[model samples]
Target: MIPVVPLDRSREAALRALVDGKAKPLGALGRIEDLAVRLALISGREDPSFDKALLLVFAGDHGLNQAGVSAYPSAVTTAMVATLLAGRASANAFARVVGAEVRVVDAGVAADLAPHPALVDAKVRRGTRNAASQPALTPDEVQSALARGAAVARRAVEAEGFDILAVGEMGIGNSASAALILHRLAPAPLADCIGLGAGHDAEGLARKHAVLAQAAARSDASDPPGVLAEFGGLEIIAMAGAILGAAAARTPVLVDGFIASTAALAAIRLEPAAADYCIFAHRSAEKGHALVLEAAGAEPLVDLSMRLGEGTGALLALPMVRAAAALLSEVASLDDVLAGRL
Candidate 1:
């Protein structure tokens, strides 16, 4: 893993002063003011540019679905990838509204998909092994997924000139995998992390709980990479890589929903510095997401009772990100305002 340097705080005091001097009541912008400070810290500029944004939606399949963990079949993973590539998915719709370019990555879908220009072919395997009885990914596959995800992110920032990055995922049964990850990584109780992922009923939720217990019992690995290999979906691991990549590039990463936050947890655990670059997008309706966010000490930007896990929540927050940057760059200082410089 590439080491990420923590944001330099040499200018933090100065940035805060600048934000405070803006033509408005002190802290009138609420969290938006805090956001501007972070943006400045990331860009090394008092007036950071957040004009260009990219959304990476990683699609994969989880073999754990075979254990009746999800309400939907694993086949839905492939179908949703097609839906995203066709520009008809909720993520695509949200991206259009926010003016962020969307790219779908074939991280580890179970089936081969037809080639599409917008799709990134970074599949590490057909699908993860059922973690209920075995490790989901091999050690080598875990490294490959991380490297591929980093490559995708580096390309977006270095080649495509994207100013910010948001990561989302599509993997049937991934919520179960994410729950397992949060349970182990967050060190939260397994029952606390388990939730009605993809709308499971009472009986289905009970079954999910039992299967996840089996998975948890199968491994005692506590480190990030080991835990990821034990239970992470390909998309989840890839999203972790993307977060690391974005942080290494000194770009802000908008982590979306529960599965995405679980990935962020892995990245931050791997490199603690990566946590400084992440903006938790929203509080997902998924019950366990609150626990994951709490463990990370993250205050999400909004709560819309959404669990749609397609980067939609992140995209919806893009406007606020833009507003944060705008406040720093466009607003006048109190000194200038009093001088009638306008």
Candidate 2:
């Protein structure tokens, strides 16, 4: 088990110096400045470099399909997973632009996918049990999903030599699951955080809310693990574990949209120290996403009304993070340029 560490004063000092550098005014870069500083502190490097980027896309299926919450069928998860492996998905295009490596993990798709070179094949189950009717996953399944996610992160940090981890998910009706998780974890109402996932109509939205409310009633928010086991999707559970594992390994994490943000919240709930290593990539347009970000105390870097959950937003924010790091490491201090004390 990797040991998770708290942010120390040394790391904090490094961030302050980097942010207070000469070329740019203090806090001028806004959240991007804070993001680079946080990344530097987490990696324990004054001149932090993000040359290697690892994106782990967790694919799963939700049992809530029976509730008519999603316009697409559960099989879409498997199809999209395959698409991702083929490097044809939108995430692929974005990742290609950033020169990042993408890996798809079948956390628990409903379909049976044969062995593929591009897919990790870490399926935990066929699909989660319908949360509207019963618990989403058994305790064993939840544990397995988390273990797989942690192992993925460990591999990226240790074996693959990646410095940063970005999380993404592909699961039908996952937006409903994310909203439910956020509602349970936060002291907020379901209506506040729920959104029109995948462009659902009024009837679909109502059904989604009803199913989520039922699941929430059966959940125990005081017990986060139990809540996750009962109502969280396989992708969400895996993401939570990945976040925790990355923090334990001192790898900076760029948290994506709504689903990813909810997963980060779950991980932080399990271990508060995990938040120290995370950078909120963007403010998702999903109704509940902003509330989740607020609950996490995270100010995201971008807010372009993005509803995509495939780490696309995080990929967009990467250049800003790199620029901040470069400024801290390469830009000369004002005193050095002026050749005198200010």
Candidate 3:
């Protein structure tokens, strides 16, 4: 079990006082104040620093694509991974604007990826088995993926000195996998969890719905690990592991939309304390995202109609996180302002 320590709330009152003491009226900063408090609480510091942020985008293929769940082919997953590595994808552009570094993890991409410094080759296998036909991952593969994900996050903090972590994913037909995981674990109905992942048409959506129904029927597992192993894409499970790992290290993780939120749900379900360290980035245009966010009890920072995953939402939200930290560290207290101690 990952030893995810519960966030300490002992500093709440003091943190609130600090925020209220800022050279502004009470609640003037709005949700930023809440965000600052959360950052402080996560770091256990009155002046938390989010100067260095890392976005880990775990990429993989899903065997369930064979079942016609996605509008795109499995090959798109590889092409997207290449695009990300070439610094040409939407995620890379957003990351450049946000000043957060992006690293792609080969959790289980179907094709062999040439080594890139920014790519962490943690492939457990060449993708997972089709959940509609069999369990997506074996118990052992699940554990390994979880471990590698945790290690990646831990190293980011302990070795690379990043102050914050975020997670995204790339996998074709993985939305079907995420929906299945969310349906079983969120205990939401299967219908509620299904969405127009990667822009499915009416017929495509119907096919995805039917395929997910078949996968859901094949597994009755309600527990976190069991549910993940049964329906998770390898990248999805690795993203959960990254969440757990970040929480274990006591670093806040900015969770990206629908797919990443599903991973966060699995992580929190596996280790309840992990929820405290997650910052749900944004709601997406994806239909099922709202339900997943609701199930996770998360109020995201923005809703830009964004559904282009690969950490784009989280990267866009990074400035707000940086601003929150600045409010705590740079803003002066009202008392000092009044005393002309600026």
- On lDDT, the candidate that comes out on top is 1
Q: What is the alpha-carbon lDDT of model 2 when measured against the actual structure?
A: 0.83
lDDT of 3: 0.91
The parts of candidate 2 lying over 4 Å away from their true place are 1-3, 340-342
**Model 3 pairs whose backbones collide:** none
Regarding TM-score, does 2 or 3 come out ahead? 3
Evaluated against the true structure, the overall lDDT of model 1 is 0.92
Model 1, 1-342: lDDT tens digits are: 868999999888999999999999998989999999999999888778887999999989998999999999999988899899999999999999889999998899999899898899999999999999999999999999999998899889999899999999999999999999999899899999988988888999999999999999999988889999999699999999999999999999999999999999999999899999999999999979999898888999999999999899999989998999999999999999999997
lDDT of 3 by residue, 49-117 (tens): 888999999999998999999999999999999999999998899888888898999999999999998
Task: Return the clash pairs for model 1, or none.
Answer: none
Write candidate 2's Cα lDDT for 209-247 as tens digits: 887788777766557777787786999999888998898
What's the distance in Å from true for residue 251, model 3?
0.6
Ranking by lDDT: 1, 3, 2
Ten residues in sequence with the least summed lDDT for candidate 1? 43-52
Residue 331 alpha-carbon offset, candidate 1, angstroms: 0.6
Task: Give the TM-score of each candidate.
Answer: 0.99, 0.95, 0.99
